[model samples]
Target: MRKPQQLRNRELVLLIFAMALTLGAFVLVQFGAIGELDTKVLGVVGIMCVLAFALHIVLRIRASQADPFLVPVALMLTGIGTAMIYRLDLAYVAHWNVGTSNAGEHQMLYAALSIALCIGLVWSLANYRVLFKYTYIFGFLGIILLALPFIPFLNGGGNAVVWISIFGFNFQPGEIAKICLAIFFAGYLVRTRESLTSTGKRVLGFTFPRAREFGPLLVIWLISMAIIVLQRDLGTGILIFGMFVAMLYVATGKTGWVLIGVFLAGAGAVAATFVMPYVHGRFEQWLHALDDDLYNASANASFQLVNGLFGMAHGGMFGTGLGQGRPDITPVAGSDYIIPSLGEELGLVGVFAILALYLIFASRGAHVGVAGQDDFGKLLSVGLSFTIALQVFIMVGGVTRVIPLTGLTTPFLAAGGSSLLANWLIVAILLRVSDAVRRQPRAVIG
Candidate 1:
């Protein structure tokens, strides 16, 4: 086994590279956009650098055995994201003469808070097993969080009622719910995997769980459908349900469970297209984004989608270069359409590199799951990893028109405080699990 100090040293080395990449991107953006570096932005970058190293220190002391690359990769993505937002902020102000977006500054602050939360979680959660004891509580809390947006007074009104306001601060409860639900799913599946695996009957070479064993799947399916129907957000519904299904398959080692999940998800989505106008409009925009009338529609039309596509095309293979391209022309470029924004400036290669980072993060997460000695840790780690992977697929697929766009933010690469918090917590949990897996004594045959 590797020494903890050795693992930490490796992490420190990679962290330096990640920080360099971040700082380099910021420098390019500053020079390309404003012809001069801004001291305030540099100060923000300094703070982010300090926070990154602080997280490394915390890991060395509390989670030295954790995966070395996860934190660095996530930090790199966050840095690039902040740089892009800052670039767009400059464009918005320069071209339109609008009030400063301040998105870049806010994203930096969010990154700091997220790192602090990650540090706190790593420090306090000395053992990941304690989470298993409160599985149902997490599940119930997840449900409550999902429902909070529906309350009249507390609701943070938007086209999609998915945010809740508390003390004048608006946050998306669904982001936090994803974590709670992942824990619940992991714990519940660990307890029930035996029946879910053994009691199923074989039909045409596939084992189908009995009605009793299938109850949990049905309940989760209902909840996912409720999210789609109630919240008017397709992405979160797909995200949560897909996460549960992935975890279920991992638990049972049964492909039949996945087949069943796909069918249910397909049915729900199809029914939604007919019954929900918003859903139907999205499908129309996706299917016929170039249609003159549809493109010309003023409200909730394909304007954003078409413009994003044009911007990406304008970028071509190598890209128009950071801050040289007009990513701000697309609506909400920092949040929902950040990929396109990056695509416009960074080109296809850059997008692929970004995707590669996600792939590495997800693969490391899966590695942690496989190395885990306990069932709960394995399931939780894999579930969390799958959540991030599936989210990336959904977001990228939507932007490329492979799927209709929904309101899901790009994981660490988008400007959303709640998403940053939830994702960092996941990273903390993964780190904790990795540390625990390494600390376990290896079994040997003499």
Candidate 2:
């Protein structure tokens, strides 16, 4: 194996190229959003450069054996996202005359904070395995984070119960909660995998786990129900339940578990639509988006989705060339609908390129999991990576009308502080695991 210094050197090289790409995006946003580039944005670009290199410096010291590709990929995606937000901010400023509350600026701030938090996690969490030791504690914290959105005073008092407002800043605790849950799931499964895999019955050429093993599955399902019924967020409910099922399958190596999860997920979705008016409405809007009367019923009715579709359609192959496209026409265009905004501006090629980045990032994350010597590391790596992939698929598929839309934001791209922070933390955790895997001694055939 190459020395840790070599890995760090490789990461340094990638960081340089990544920062250049980010600068190019920033430059494009400036030119497209306005007729000329601004020095202020340039300053922000310079800050990001410093921050990116500073992060690399920390990695060199803290996680020298970490995967070289992950951080660079994250930086690139974050840059692309910041550029899009900047473009929208420019349009909003010009149209509404509101020079304050710039989403792009906030995104940059979040990026810096996220990188710092990542550095902190790596610095403090010397051994990823210690997380397994405190699995229950992390699980408890995860549950509290998930429940925070429902606190009467903390609640953002919006349609979403997944957000809490602190000192005028709206935060989605679910983002962090999901990360904590992945760790807890990985650890818990490691402890219980042997019992969970005991053969119970054979049916249709498939073997199922024992009746007692169903406890965890039932608990996850119930949590998903509460998230949908009480929290009023179907997307998060799906994401949480789906993530648990994925980890369970990985732990137990049971095809039966996945099949069961698929069935439960479908049934739960149908049940939620019947029981929850908000969920039902979303499904109806998705199903009948093209119907003119429904589309025009209310100003905010189906307009967002319809507008997003029109934007993408307008974009076609090559988008209207970044800032030239009218992405601001869609509501919440900087967050949940950011991908559509990008699809509109960058065209299909840009969209494909972005997806490819996600693909590579996730692939490397999975590789880290597969290569790890310990079960906890493997489970944690796979769970974290799968969570991201599933979220992206749901977000992109929803925008494209491939699935009913969810309220989840596009990761590293959308204008959400909570997502920014949580994703960066995840990167830190994955890098730590990667380092551990690399440091592990190779098996000897002799």
Candidate 3:
């Protein structure tokens, strides 16, 4: 067994390396003359680094038995996000008459807050099974939170009612709701899966679930529709519904559930396209952009998509040597559209490398689910992994135009406080599950 001191040394090394990478990137951007950098910005970043390193030490001392990969992975992601946000801020300084310092400061602040929250979450929920007890309550609360942004007095943004300003700070309830709903769905499916599979009947060619078995799904569907109607956020609504369906399939290993889900999703899409003006407009823009431009004859709908594709194409194999390319040309370079910005600056190879990291992360999560001792543990791990996988697919596909554009933030990479915090919390929970699995005893045989 490795000595505790040796483990501590390794963690310290990892934390230092992470901080160095972030600071190095900031220095390179500032010195390369790609964009101007203010000393205050660097000082802010330095402070963040010191705080993160300090937090790392605290976590190591408090949770010595926690999954080793958890803190390192979190640090690496936070570092990468900071680097990218700084790069984008530099670009903003070059183009618009806006100050780039605020973006960097906000990102750094959010990263610090996210790290603190992740550590607290990991410490508080050391035992993964505790979450199972309040799954239903969490799920209901999640639904309420999801709908909170749509409340008449609280809603913000006309494009999507995803933000609610509270005491001057804007919050995205959907981000927190996603994790809570995942927990609830995992527990619900694990408990009800046997009944769902055993009670279904073979109707014609497809197996049809009993009416009672479909109650939860119907309620979920209704909730999804409510999201679409009230928030006008088709992407989030679909994401939540799809996550539930995937978890249900994993829990029961039932093809019928998947088929029903696909059917329902298809029907929902058709209904939404015909009924909701926003949905109709997006679909129309996606389908007929070459002919009639929805956002004007300038083809602005196609413009951003085209620019993203061009960025990827320009990236080719190796990127334009970070900071050499014009990533700022793509709209929303710091948020939902950050992938293409990465592609422009880091190249296709870098993009593929990031994708591989996510794949590896997801694979590890699946391993945890398979190895877990209980149904709830299995479902929770699988659900969290599936949520990350789906989010990646949706955002990447949206940027590539493999699917219609959806304003979904890239997990870990995108510059958003809510997204960063929520994803890190999800990672913390996954680590808790993984640690439990590793500590579990093997079954005895006769």
TM-score of candidate 3 on Cα atoms, chains taken together: 0.89
Question: Each model's TM-score, in the order given?
Answer: 0.98, 0.97, 0.89
Q: What is the lDDT of residue 337 in candidate 2?
A: 95
lDDT of each: 0.91, 0.88, 0.77
Q: Evaluated with TM-score, which candidate comes out highest?
A: 1
* Cα lDDT tens digits for candidate 1, 1-446: 78889889998998999999988899999898888988888888888888889989999888888889899999999999989998999999998888777888888899989988998999999999999999999999999999999999999999888998999988999999999999999999998888889767889998888888888999999999889998998999999999999999999999889989999999998999999999999899889999998888987689999999999999888899988999999989999899999999999999999999999999999888887778999999999999999999999998899998888999999998999999999999999999998888871101
The lowest-lDDT stretch of 10 consecutive residues in candidate 2 is 437-446
Q: Among these predicted structures, which one has the highest lDDT?
A: 1
Model 3: runs farther than 4 Å from truth?
1-17, 33-43, 46-65, 99-101, 203-208, 288-300, 443-446
Q: Write the per-residue lDDT of candidate 2 for residues 238-294, one digit (tens) a residue.
A: 999999999999888898888888988999988888988788878878899888887
Q: Model 2: number of clashes?
A: 1
